[model samples]
Target: MAETNSSDTRILMFPWFAFGHMTPFLHLANKLARKGYRITFAAPRKAINQLEPLNLFPDFISFHPVTVPSVTGLPPGAETASDIPISLSRFLATAIDLTIDQLKSLIKSISPKLIIFDTAHWIPQVAKPLGIKTMCFKVVSASSIALVLVPARNIPTDRPVTVEDLASPPPGYPSSSVVLRGKELQTLLFVTNPFGDGLTFHERITMSMKNSDVLAMRTCHEVEGNLCDYIGSQYQKRILLTGPVLPEESKSTLEERWGNWLARFEPGSVVFCAFGSQIILEKTQFRELVLGFELTGLPFLMAVKPPAGTTTIEEALPEGFEERVKGRGVVWGGWVQQPLMLAHPSVGCFVNHCGFGSMWESLMSDCQIVLAPHLGDQILNTKLLADELEVAVEVKREENGWIPKENLSEAIKLVMDKDSEVGKLLKENHNKWREIINPKLVNEYVDKFVQSLHEVVG
Candidate 1:
């Protein structure tokens, strides 16, 4: 145990409300559980239930749920870090104060040694005065990190909108594996400093990690060694490449589900499509996607998000679209067990928004990708996963900044086409990756992460 005893080291992990943000932090909380660290994870009471299965979350770790007020303009019933809106600024303006108040009250009930946070960098402001150390547990792609800090064009500069010199070698990384795309740009934006807020915010975030203490990632160096090393040097912080923190239970369930689903199909057949949680599609756009997917003449399972901000699935769906595709497709209105869905044997390819966490999860689960990235750093991740790794194909984009139905359909067909080279290579890589990454997930990924904590507080 780190700290004074097995029961003493308590982590106060406050993840953002988006499911993507919550994914890695909770996996980390569970890892800490195996190591005997007590935890009081603070978030709205509404959000904790989705993570209920994690209740087996070891003997040492425990949850502390808080209620977020029903504020206007956010999602209805929105409660915790995982349910908050995607607007970084607006969400932060509301969430920071509420989260601090919630945490402060929770702290009165249980004081702990460390506080790990993601999304909102303002957490250090609240934790520092309390004598609690804060670790910025940002969910990022290691390749994206390398590409961002490589003395790129328009990076960290006023009036610098385009990324340049991103093709430069990622520092502390093997050059042979380093790669970037011609049109793709790296992200200089982040949770707190999305449009160059100021040197103050970046300095605050970077300074928080000046220590040799772990600046862990949601990746494993074994799979992305060059990218990992590049990040460590760029951030100037100790790097821990912990693989994607996924639900352990979901893995078993997926094996069962996939085994069953595969029974209904030939080997190497279905295509899986899902935009991660927090993506709200317009009704018109949703209808177009349905048309595209149906036209591809491939078996698919889509985890669809309901419309937010005056949009709804029923309104967006094509007339009788659900009925026509009845037995062939399954579309859900909310979050699905993503990793499990992707890893199914029947699933040969994945369509994603290029969220790094989703990308890593798909790769780890042995699913080839058909990427359709929208806003945020997803564009950056798509560049790395689609262009650099070459394990995925980019969905064609429209002049309007989104892929039309035709392009989307074409991309999926290419990725899943039995006779296409892209499909063949992706399938080969998928099997190889499944073999390579499994050992880390089961054998040593979580253990190394826990070891770092024990070393720190012991």
Candidate 2:
């Protein structure tokens, strides 16, 4: 390793080619760049373009765009893991692995002091032999990482990890209880399988951690301190906490169309519902969610991505459903400014998919949570909040883990109905947790992380 002054220190970031992973990497890049370290951030060109709206990176940050290599059976222009259906995501992983030589060439050209790569699993090995220091940046929560760190023997090497295997508490789990169900467990297994190319996601993450010099997580001691400590002790590696890596708030306001619409509702009277970008609800599921919203008789705003291969939410809505709920509901398509939405006074409860980004963002606000976990670590995250932390309420799901239509209204009522006992508890817990999650505390952790990075490279 070479010693360099802070002004000359350069770090390259290569997160998994998805917004959920890329956004946090970008946030950290901005933070590091702001602190006077030169940054060279790299990812698929499409993924880089996605950051344009946020203007997250300073001019000091350099962008290195990697052309996504083609994969057989993958749709043209689907460069990201989120662009295609879940089954085809593995192809994107395969394509990314094929870019190792290109990445190596970039490393040679820029000669960064360190390379920060997220979850790709193959990046660290590529950088190591070239004499570059590497750090694995986990964008997910510590609990999610802890879940994957479960010993391999428990995952059944002879076969794919079963639902039951996942539901049982992994050895050394902080709790004695199971955290995932059959359906959510299945999604976790499916998403982690290196895009279903060969190695399980957990195996790749374990190997990546083993290969990297250090691990940088997007969380802090005030939130998941125990899990972070457990991971460091179990893995025998240094962990640098990035304290949520929350980007600076956007200066622009929400688009006028929805902005004016939301103003009609009283403060704390509207439900703001959104799942993260990758979740494409099935039409049947979308209809049920809408019906649930209607049953609550509450003013609501929903933003949904049409399912893959489809163009609009109208195609998924039940017949005459839009007209029926016209005055009380507004369903918009495609992405919106999420932070602004959460900050709105009219928004009281966030009905979310429990993505770690969403979870932390919601916690940072006054909004209470109504969790409907859709995939991967979301199950564990939901459990940590609703079951263990008691700050949020889980929508009741059927035995197989599907949220029935009825559970939707019931879950919302439990969180939003002020007079209800569960609702009062949920709000109380939200307020208590929010105090602990203040910006000042998180920034202190960020300062420590920057100091640690300086120690590593100075």
Candidate 3:
């Protein structure tokens, strides 16, 4: 390889084939590009069009579209996890794995200073021979990594990992507050299941982290320092923090229809709920969730995907629900501008699935938080926000992980009620945290993170 100029060092970003992973990778790319570093972001060809508008620094950051070769059982044109149901994610993983040769060619041609990735565990091996350093940048919270992915969670060769094994944290795990309970333990079963070809999701991520030259997270030390430290100790690799990598302020405005709808409500009275792109609730659960919002008797705007086996949000609504909540509530099937909606003064309470990205967005906004986590990482994130930080409340769940409408209603009321002591305390704590995670502090983390990248590559 020809010697590259230090001033012209470019960083390559290749996240797993999922929107949750890819979106954060791009956010960090924007941050690095702002500091004058060029970034080459690689993702499926189809996803690039969707992600293009988010490329704020298009002059400094460019997209490389990788064609996902078809794999058995993978639906045609399903380039991302969002395109298919959760059950078929393994097929997407396999398809992404098949693109290794294309990626290797890209790496050889570009010869970037470093490659940052998650879940694509082969990156280090592929980049090492090309003289490119690799960083396994985890977009999920460090607490989730520490809780399950660390080396201490011994994978017994004699027997498969059972729910019993996940009931408590592994020995030397970082925090007691992040444990999973009841049916939530079932979510971790995917760790042991085959993700792509022969590798399980756990194997894939841990191998990526284990092989990378460095490990980093989209979090700051103030919130998860101990968890990050524990991961570092177990992996024996240096850990870099990116301080949540919050999105830059947008120049665009909320859509006029949404703006007009929200304007009808008083400030701090409307409840806005959004689960991330991946969650597709069952019909019963979907109806229960909307009914929960109605039971609160508060105006709400729910942006959710259609329920399983349903064609539209309207089809899944409980009988008489539309007429009952008619003018005060809206159940939107399509996407809504989440950050802008959260920023709207009328949106006082945010009920979210607690994905890491949404967690940061909620933390930065003025709205009171209500968590309804649907996955392993999300559950851990909920624990961090509700239990560890005490800045949010999680809705109560049954033994089967079903959230009753009454419980959801009560959780919302706990945060939205003006006179509730819990609501007051949560608001105060959230404000303090919002101040700590301000843009100034996040920029400082990015500064240090870039400095570390330079040192590693050099």
Q: Clashing pairs in model 1?
A: 16-81, 17-81, 17-82, 153-164
Give the per-residue lDDT of model 2 (tens digit) for 1-458: 11233466889888888888888888887777767778888888887778756545456677889989888978998888778876676788788878888888998999888899966687777777877788998888788778766343256777666666666655666653325655566755653465436867677677778778998888877667878887887778899998878877677898897779889999999999999888888777788888899888999988888854568887778788888899879787878888999998889989998898998888788887999987767877887788766888878878776677789998898888888898888778888888887888777877798889987766
- The C-alpha local distance difference test score for the whole of candidate 1 amounts to 0.64
CA lDDT of every candidate? 0.64, 0.79, 0.90
Worst 10 residues of 1 by lDDT: 191-200
Off by over 4 Å in 3: 1-6
TM-score of each: 0.81, 0.94, 0.97
**lDDT tens readout by residue for model 3, 89-127:** 988888888999999889888889899999888889999
Give the best candidate by TM-score: 3
Model 3: lDDT of residue 11: 90
Best by lDDT: 3
Compute the lDDT of residue 449 as modeled in candidate 1.
71
Q: Give the TM-score of candidate 3.
A: 0.97
